[model samples]
Structure formats: C-alpha cells, structure tokens
Target: MATPIQMPSLSPTMKEGKIVKWLKKVGDKVSSGEAVAEVETDKSNLEIEAFDDGYLLQIVVGEDQMAAVGAPIAFLGAKGEKVDAGKSAAKPAEAPSAAKPPPPPAPAAKPAAAPPPAAPAAGGGGGGRIAVAMPSLSPTMKEGKIVKWLKKVGDKVSSGDAIAELETDKSNLEIEAYDDGTLAEIVVGENQTAEVGAPIAYLTAKGGKAAAAAPAPAPAAPAPAAPAPSAPAQASGGGQVVPLRREEPAAAGGRRLRASPLAKKIARERGLDINQVRGSGPSGRIVKRDIEEALTKGVSAPAAKKAPAPGARPAAGVRPEPQVVPLTSMRKVIAQRMTEVKPGVPHFYLTIEVDMDAAVKVREEAKAMDLKVSVNDLIVKAVAMAVRRYPKINVSLQGDHVVQYSTVDVGIAVALEEGLITPILKDADQKGLQAISTEVRELAERARKRALKPDEYTGGSITVSNLGMYGIDQFVAVINPPQASILAVGAVADKAVVINGQLAVRKMMTATLSCDHRVIDGAIGAEFLRELRGLLEHPTRLLF
Candidate 1:
C-alpha cells in the first residue's frame, strides 16, 4: 500500500508552507525519522521528517510550491511497487481551513525494511501507562525549558489539568494531562531544557506500577512511544477551556500587573498597558474583550524612554588589539538584509520637529496613576493612526507593484545581543495606548531573548526606532526592505520657541522618516509626518 506524506502543521498560525528544498528525490529509499524536506512556515524554517520507511515514489508538491496543512506533499511506497506516475503526480488539493489533521499512515502491507524502533513508554507498564514527551508548542520552537512543574512526583492529576509551564522561544505555555493518572516520575527537572519529542515525564493509572525515582534515559533508537497528545485530548494556552493557572503579574521597572496569558499576549501585540485595562473575566481576570473595549474607548498611553546604552564600551585604548567577534546567525541575517535593502531600495528622508508640551502633560497624568506609559507609545499610536490616512506610506514594493496594506501594523525596532528584531504590532491604528505599552514590553522582552515567532517579526509596512533614551538628537535610520518607511525618533528636550508670538521654553522632539521612493513619494511622506506631528502636538486627540 502507498503511504501518503502529508504536510504537517508546524505552527498554530501556519495555514500553508512553502517547500524550501527536498532532501529525498524519487527512487531514493527513505527511512522513518529521516528528514525529507525543508519547509518554510510563517514562523521559521523547519525540517519535515518521514513517518514511514519506503522508497520516495513521488513528489506531489515540488520545491518552492506551497501546500496547505494535511495536503499530501509526497508519497512513499515499497521499492519497485508499480506506482502509476500519472496518478501520483496529480496536484494535491488545498485542505479546508478547518480540516481535521489526517490520520497517521497505516502499517505497510509488507515490510520494506526494519521499521523504526518504537520509543519505550515511560513507567514501562503493560496496561495503560502513558509516556509524555516535550511537544512542539509553537511553530518555530526547537527546544523548550521546563520553567516549572505544576504537578509533583506521585501527584494525582485529571485530564486537562496543566502539568507544567514550558517556556518556548516565543512565550511561556502550559502543558496539560491527557489521561487521569498519577504522575509517575519527572525525567526533566524544572529549569532544565529538552528537545522536542524527548520524554519529559510519565504517568500511570492509579494502583499500577510503583513510580520510579527518575525516568530512565531514552534508549538509543527507542520506539517513538510518545507522540504529542492528540488534538481531541490536548489544548493550547488560549484554547476554549481556559485552564486557570496562577501566573505572576509581568513586571516592568519594579511594577507588576496581573493579566492572563491570552490577555498578556493580546496586550503585547497591540502595545497596551495591562495595568490600565480593566479585567472582565472571572475574579477580575483580564481577557481579550477588556483589551478591545479599552481600545474602543480611545485611551492612549505615553511612550517608553530608551534604556541607557551600556556604560560606553570600556575604553578601546586599554591594551586592546582589535577584538574579533564572530557574527551570530541572527546578526549575519541582519547584515545580509541590510546589504540588500540599503542599496537596492532608493530611500528619501523627511525630518520634522514636534511640540511635546501636550504629550508631556499626558505622560505626567498617566504617571500619577502609576501607569508606566512612555512617549514612544504615544508616538507609535499617532504614527499608526496617521498612516491610516496616508495609505501610500503604509505600503510595500513587490516587484513593480506597490501593495497598500489594509490594516495599520507597525514594527518597533528592538536592539538585542544577537542583532536587532522588530516585532510587529498588528493593527496598531486600532489599539489604545495601554494596549500598545503592554505589547511593546512583551515583544521587546521576547525579542531580546531571541524568542520571537516568525509572524511576530515578519510583516509590517513601516517601523519605528526610538533613540531618545540614548539622547540622540537626530539621525537617519536605514530602511528595512519591502516596507515603505521607518520613523527615527530623538530625545525630547526643552527649547526656546515662539508660542502665540511670545518666546517661551517648550518641550520639543525631532523625528525623521526614511521613505522608500519606489512606494512613497516625497509629498506623500511629508503629508504623513504632518498628520503625525499634529496628533502628537494635540495628545488629547488620541483619546478619541
């Protein structure tokens, strides 16, 4: 019988994936657990492995083509198995958006070679003992740290009870139990990291085998006994049945705000302050609706000041022979991108000064309530709202075509040890200040830890880079490719200026907009900045 190799759903948000390259060609023998293709999902690149051993009989989706999740990408069958080339070459249909995952390939009619060894079940009992393994929580995660264990050794747990909090590259997520049982043993301790598909713990039915002190290490070429709990039995952190777990409020500069994981994720993505957003969920638990209502009310928060640059790189004069530093993978990619975007995209610049008196007043008022809003947050809201009016400025150049985005998603540039990453605030124009602040804090936290998901960092028509905290008066920022513009912000300082024909000292800030001439003209970019300046100059306008 022919075994179909379906496109695996790599991430929660991934609908389809592009085949970057095929490792196995037709007529080549393939083994179970062997990587056959490299796929690019919305989040990152990952290798897809074979589940059955056989000859690579057909390639259904060739290199560079995209196939929806569960769509057959290839077929594996016994060598010289008489596959009809015409039928096997037929194009695979796109799986329906809500399609259930395909069932695992049935056992081969006759064995091709020795089937891969089955991973040993933890607890090693014959009856219903189940082995639990580290699951692929998010699309881009390769490994995860066991932040904490929710259930201890020999603790009784019911199906759906959260067993642990796994910290992935993007965020922390909870792991739940599938069957009611007593946790037998902990293989990976708290604070320890494990690769995906590695056994982490075990569970056995009550009154079964006496629990072991520690889970035995996985055997060499052991049977793959622990598959991630099936969808019918498992749920994500934000899934329908919200599992109530005690989460400490996230801290920002010595202040903590209590919010649910879903609420935190939403707040961070929208750049909202979780502290200001009221909670409507049970016992004042903040959820998605509260964040939405806060935005509808048009409440805006202040922006964050940049953290001081680390005490000026210790004097290079102190017996330093030019230090050699190797570029990290992320830094190398950043370098490559800059090389492509800086020269290939023709860039134009526009600079403007804004009277920050009203914005400053707004920040002071927010501070009275202990809201840690920053000036940058206000500027992001203003720029996003302004971009909505000047659609050309919110666009990307695709070949000769200018693609104007419908939603106002803005990217905030965050500098990290391994290069810089811009985690996007999707639909920034529609969010309130509090929401933007929360999101910016979370995204910045994760980006610095090198844990942002692909979609979180990928799409944005414009980006904002603030250097006010570093006291940069003004500077031009290089454009990120495809996007039409990037806004560079400088520090706010008191300066002598004319207010109603009288000389007075007023708070002022400088901002420069770097534009891609292919997608935005000088007039278009200038008009956008004019609206932005007006919004910031009248901070109250952001309230409505």
Candidate 2:
C-alpha cells in the first residue's frame, strides 16, 4: 500500500517548516524510523524520519520550499509500486482568518463590547450560582490542564477575580470569575484535563445550594471537522491556491520563459520547468496562463545553466520572484498580541542622546580584563540602574493600577526568523557587567533555538531593544504589555560635538524610551532617561 508522508510539527509552535533537503532519493528508502529529509523551522533545523519501511517513491514538496504542518512532503510504497502521490496527498486548506477582520486577540475573553447575557450555559443554576467551566485560555486550545485552583470550596469569590490557573496551548493563564459568589464545589481537580466550556467548578450565593454538573467526555469532538469544512472554502477561493494543482510534462513546443510572480510561484511549487514555456505577456514574460498552457500543451524547457566561475557575481537582470509566506504560529501570536496592546493604551516616546566616550573607554578596559561586555549588555546594565533610581520605569500598567516591581528584571529582545522573543535577566540591577553579559548571551542563544522555558521568557518589568549593532541611529519600540516601558538603544559612534567650548569628536549614542502614559507620565520617563544618561556618561557609577 502506498502512503503519503506528511510534514511534521518540528517545533512546539511551528506551523510550517522549509524542506532543507531530502537525504533519501526516490527508490532508496527501506527502513522504518529512518531519517528521510531535513526540515528547517524558525527555531532549528531538524531531520524528519519515516515511520514505515518502504521505498521512497516521490517528493511532494521540494527543497528550499515551505510546507504547512500535515501537508504531504513525500510518498512511500513497496518496491516497484506505483505511488499515486497526487491522489494520496491532501491539498493545503485556505485560511478563513484572511476573509474575516482579525478577531480580537484570543486572550481577551469578551469582545470590546460585552454581549448581553445568554440563555444559560452548562454551569448556570437556579440560586444565583453560575458554573465556572474550564476556560479556553489560548487560541487553538482544545483541552486544558488545570495547574492549580486559586479559590477552594467555601471561599468567597468576587467577580473578575482569578479562581484557577490553566496551562493552555500557549501559556499558563488564570481563570477569572464571572459572578460574585462562594466557591461551593470543585468539579474538576487540579492536574486534571477538561474540555473547554466543561464545568471545572461551581460557585453559589450565600446559603444557596450548589449546582450538580457532569464533566462529560463528549463534546462531539470537533477537531476532525476543521480539516473537512475548509475544503469547500479552499475550492471557492480558486485564485489563492498554487499547491493544489498537479503538473505534467508537455511536448516540447513553446517560447522562452521569464515568469511573473504568480506564474513563477506556481511553476516552482508544481515542480515545472517553465524556462522555455510559451508566454503572452510583455517581453515574453511567462504568466499563469503560460504555466497552465505549458502543462497541457507542452513547452521546450531550456537546458540547465552552466556553472559560474569562482568569485563571480550572479547574472544581471535576474531578480528573485516575490512570493507569499504564510505566518508561523509565533508570528500570528505576536501579531495578535501587538494588535491587542498597541491601541487603547496611551503611548508616549522620549528620546535622549548621551555622550558615550567614557562608557566606550570603560567597555574597552572591561574587554582587556577578559570581560564579554557588548553594547546591549552595557545598555542593559544602565537601564537596570536607571530603573532602580526611578522605580516608576519598572512598573506594569494593570487595569486601574500601577505595579512597581521591587526587582529590576530587564528583558532583552531577541529577533527570531518569524518573530521576536524576550528572555529576562532577573535582578539586573544587582548583577555585575560580566554576569549580565554572560546571561544575556545565553538567554539570547536559547531564545533563538526556542529552548527557553516559559518562565525564562516571561515576567520582565522592562525590556531593552537594541538595533545599535545593526547601525540604526534610533527607533522606537512598542511597549510589551504589563511592562511599563521599553528602552531602544542605538549605535555608539564618533560624532562632532562641542565639549566646554571646542568642537571635538566624541562617542555618542541615542536612546529612546517608549512608555505607557498611564503608568509613566512624561516627566517620569524623562527623569528616568536623565538618570540613565548620567550613569552611562559617568561610567564609574555603573561599576558599583
């Protein structure tokens, strides 16, 4: 029997991965659990193994191209078996989110306008008791594990108070109460898993009877419905698809090919050699029509190009094709979080330029002392010290409250291929420059590998985003939520400046602080930057 080998989920949050290379070519595979192909996800490059022992019959997705999770990448079959890869492979489904305006961030339980009360859900009782079910804490969360219960039976629970903690698909978030009541009965125990909307606990009014609820296993299992329902939508959205179409070699008869982006993408995906395909566009540029015609009406494919000489540049007038890259899970989460946090929260940016000559000299001296201090490490140290002097800079703008953290945990933004992740240097103000340097490097390396645990990335009071290494003069960064401020650090380079009275060259850097106006007022943000500039300019102050 011929079976299709589907793309595997390589990382915890990977939606897709690029096919790096196939280790085994067609007719070469024979063992189960053997490595077949290498896949490169945003996190790391890993080899995907074959589960069944069979001959490698066909490659569905080619090298250097991306495939969504569960999309077929190859076909396997017995020796001399005919593998109908096209029939066995499932077509990539169209995304429904593209048609709908981005829904409110999945974390926000209710939309901006809370809807009117519904007829009674699973947990509603007669005596002012509403059932508190296992909540859907993250998008794509089906069932959740209850990490701990915050409120025990007989405890008074206030509306909007966190009653339990759940470990969801993304992160661990608390379950909040919807009505004021007493915790009457715990339906689901801690460490137990329950379906979303299934009763986890029951809350009742004072002297009110508890509601009897059953946490049934049956929710009709809607998981399989997603793959089935999207086929019609995918077929309806005709122009959007490229991978679903199969290709065949035609008789040699067509014009030279210089393909359009759409035509080029289609050709690349379908494994078509459109180099000599007939074109109807300007200057004989191959269009989608040309690709379709070539598949059906044959085209004369151009011979493979000769190898270029050593150190030679790429051919002139040969531009890479512009194609679509779907959003990864990390990117989608980032987009959702940013869209949710950026608006509605008032933001203010403050920029300051500082003399970096002294700090630069100190860094050189540290390097001589075998210290691994870099520009970001210095900024992290400075920001940490600044927050200590002005605690308002290390605060979170919670709803109707400002939380000023006692410890200065500075977050360093590490860029990934698909998105940005921050890993914290806890108690940064208390650590030495060398210690900060080492920790930042380790955190960043792990972050890039997506190996950092949830605790390592979360709970930072303030974040430092440095583009100085990239030679950026200055840029503002959006404040990470719950975080009151983000400091953007630019390059430390020589510039002509007036010191005392004479115009001389000095190392100078620009730093911008983006603040949530609710937590940090304009003056507070300025004062914090002033304190930061003093530390960096003096250099000696940061040594302690």
Candidate 3:
C-alpha cells in the first residue's frame, strides 16, 4: 500500500506552505518517525516526518513550491512497485539535472537500504505516552529561547506543572507540562531555541514499562548564548555539516555587498559575502555579517581602490545621496492599511476634553491600597461599560445590514520596538478594575513582544490609544475600519480654572474620539464622549 504524504497544517491559521527542501529523494528507503522534508509556513519552517516506512515513490512538490494544507507532496510505496508517474498525485520534483538534458541512468536497481528502528518515544520507556510540542507564545515568535528547565529527564511531571521558562520576543513565559508522565528526554536545552510546534521534550505514561526502554540520556547542553546573526540555518540530522553552494557572487567593484545593520555587523566581524548570504531572518532578510564573513574568508573579490576625493570628481551633476532605512514588517503593514483605509473609507474626527480630577483621586486612593492601577485600565473599563450604555457606537459596519456587538471587547494599542499591535481585553465590561489591570499588563507585554494571537488583534468593538506617557495634549486618531470609533488620550496636566467663582488649579486631561460617520452620527458620538467625560471627572461614578 502506498502512503500519501500530505502537507500538514503547522499552525491553526496556516493556509499554505512552501516546500523548502526534501531530506530524502525518491527511491530512498524511509522509516516511520524519520524526517522526510521541510516546509515553510507563514509562521515558521518545520520538518515533516514520515508516519509510515517505505520507499520514496514520488515527490509531488519541489523546493520553493507552495501548496495548500492537505495537498499531497509525496508518496511512499514498496520497493520495485510501479507508481502512476502520470497521475496528478505527483508534482514535478526539483532536480538540478532536469534543467538541462542529462545522460540516462543505468537500468532500475533495488531500492536503497531502509532506515533504523524508530527511537523510543521521549516519555515512553515502560508505558506509551506522547510528547507535546511547546505551544506558540505569540504570533511573531518563530522560536523561543529556553531560559531554564524546571524538570530533569526521568522526573515525574503532572499536567500544568511548569516545565520550562521560555524567553519569547515579548516576555519570559513558563512552559507547562500538558500530561501526567515521566520526563523521557529534552530534545532542546536551556538557552537553545526550538521552533513553534517542534518537539522540545518527551513524556511517558506514569509507571509504564516503556519508560525503561528509553535511550541513554544525553548530557544537557546550554542554549544559544545570543540571537544568531543571520536567519537560523537549518540543521541536518546528526549535526553534520551540509555544504551550501553559492549560485552567484555578491560583490560589486571588488567591494562586498551591503545588507542590514545586524548583517553588516556580523559580516564586518566575520568577513562574509552579502550576496551569497541567504537570509533566513525575518522576511528573507540579509544582514551585515553575511557579507563580512565572505570577505574575511576571501570568498568575495578583494576591495577595489578608493574613489577620488569628492572635489576631484569630474564636473558632473551633483551626487545623489543614498537613503538608508530599516522598515519593520509592522510598519509596512501599517502603511499599506492606512493607504487602503484613507481612499476607501469616509473618515470623520471628533475631539473632546475630559476632566480627570476625580479619576486621578480614585487612582491615588487605589494606589494607597497597593492596587497600582493605571488611568488607561480605568478608561478601558469605562469604555466597555459605556458601549453597553450606547450600543450605537459599539456597532460594526456591514454591507446592507449593521452588525452590532452584544459584548464589549476593547482593544488597547500597545507599541513595540518593531511595531504597534492591539491586544483586545475580551469582555472588558464584565471584568473588574484589578482584573482589567492585570490583563492589560499581560496583553501589553505580549503585544510588545509580538506574541499576540490573531484573535487578540481582531474582533474588537472599539480601540483606545494613549500618548499620556509621552505628554501629548490631545490628538484625533484615524478610525480602524469595520469598528465605529477609537479614543485617543492625551497627557493629564494641571491647568488654572474657576471653581465656585474662585481661581484654582485643576488636573485636566484631553481625549479625542474618532468615529466612523457611516455608523455613528455626530450627536450619538458626542453623547457617548460626554458620558465618558463625566465618569472620568467624577471618578466616584466608576466606584459605583
């Protein structure tokens, strides 16, 4: 019987993947539990392992070819079995010899040697138990840096026990054991990185006999000290060096090519080629060291002679300055989305100044009680509560019919080193002040690290943007489409005002509400803001 190798969905949101490489070729003997190929999904590159052993009969997709999940990529069958080469099941394999006419090979021979017996499952030495891959901590996190391991191999573990501390792009997360069992082996070490969905360790059922058959324990090793300079190089099984051939030189006028700052730094220190460097970094990025190492090793041609002084240049036109920039993925997305929304949606802006003296007093009082809550948290709670009071502003615009939300999910804009992401406070109206504060802190930390899930960024009824920390007075925000409005908060400062016919100073904060005219009218939006302003000013209303 032939086994179909279909593309597996690496992540819940992954729709397609690009075949990055084939570890085994057709006619090669395969075994269950052996890796056969590598696939690159939207999130990360993962190895696809064989589920059944057999001879590689056909490869349906070649390297770099994209296929949707469940699409067949290869097939396995018995040796000497005739495969339907003409069937749609087989995709053209990527072969260097296929590009040009090649000499015919000798007559078909017997299939190659079979793989070794399958290794013992991580936890199963005496009883059968499966290993659970580390859960993805965030969307942008491809790999996690292991900070420490809480359990040693052969230690007993129970569900929900913290097994490891994972340093993600956002924060340090504790990886929990998902099953009750004995730890079999740790595939990855402390400080080492394991891609999302890649097995990090194994677990065996408690008191299972299979646990005694576990392989000899390998010595624990330290994780990578720091982030790799270049995109992570794929490692072959057994850690053997796989020679990578460069198809083209990456130099100009004998000078090594230029790439990213990080790449450049790495290149300068290592002396590598910029062109031959295949960036596995974010978005196929090439960096500095990729070029530097090539240069140091004499991989690229020697540097050319320096050009004449600027004044010695021939009386030609003025020299143009080169523009240097490092655009992040988030910035690029923001640019494209803003451009799309500006042209397609009719936008309207409204600004309102909210008196926050009471809110400030309440927060101060809460602080005295050791409840360190922020004004933003209170605003989030207030907005969620107000949405229920004013359902018109909580609605999303849909074609023909208006889509109104019964529950309020408030999105708080959090800024990261690379970009900005919004992590929603699910059912904010139902959560109390302390709960909202804790969740906001957690989500903000995750958002900054790019670890938020897709659901965390979508399906929000309204958004809140605060520049109070930066001391901005007030500013109107562009409406994030589908939802009706977004609130922009400015700095809270003391200003002179008349109180009961006497001159006094009062703490004031300005808030601007940007609304989508298609769904929320001026009067309706204004009323909502008015109510929000009253809550913030009185502060006691929030306590009630």
Best by TM-score: 1
What local distance difference test score does each model get? 0.63, 0.61, 0.59
Q: In candidate 3, what residue range of length 10 has the lowest lDDT sum? A: 218-227
- Alpha-carbon TM-score of each model against the true structure: 0.47, 0.42, 0.45
Candidates 2 and 3, the one with greater TM-score: 3
Q: Please state the error at residue 2 of candidate 3 in Å.
A: 9.8
**TM-score-based ranking, best first?**
1, 3, 2
Q: Per-residue lDDT tens digits of candidate 3, residues 57-88? A: 76554443455555455667888665653132
Candidate 3: stretches off by over 4 Å: 1-13, 16-68, 72-132, 153-161, 177-185, 202-350, 357-378, 390-406, 411-426, 431-465, 475-486, 496-507, 513-531, 534-544
Clashes of 3: 39
Question: What lDDT score is found at residue 481 in candidate 1?
Answer: 65
For model 2, what is the C-alpha lDDT against the true structure?
Answer: 0.61
Model 2 scores worst on lDDT over the 10 consecutive residues at 239-248
Give the residue spans of candidate 2 off by over 4 A: 1-343
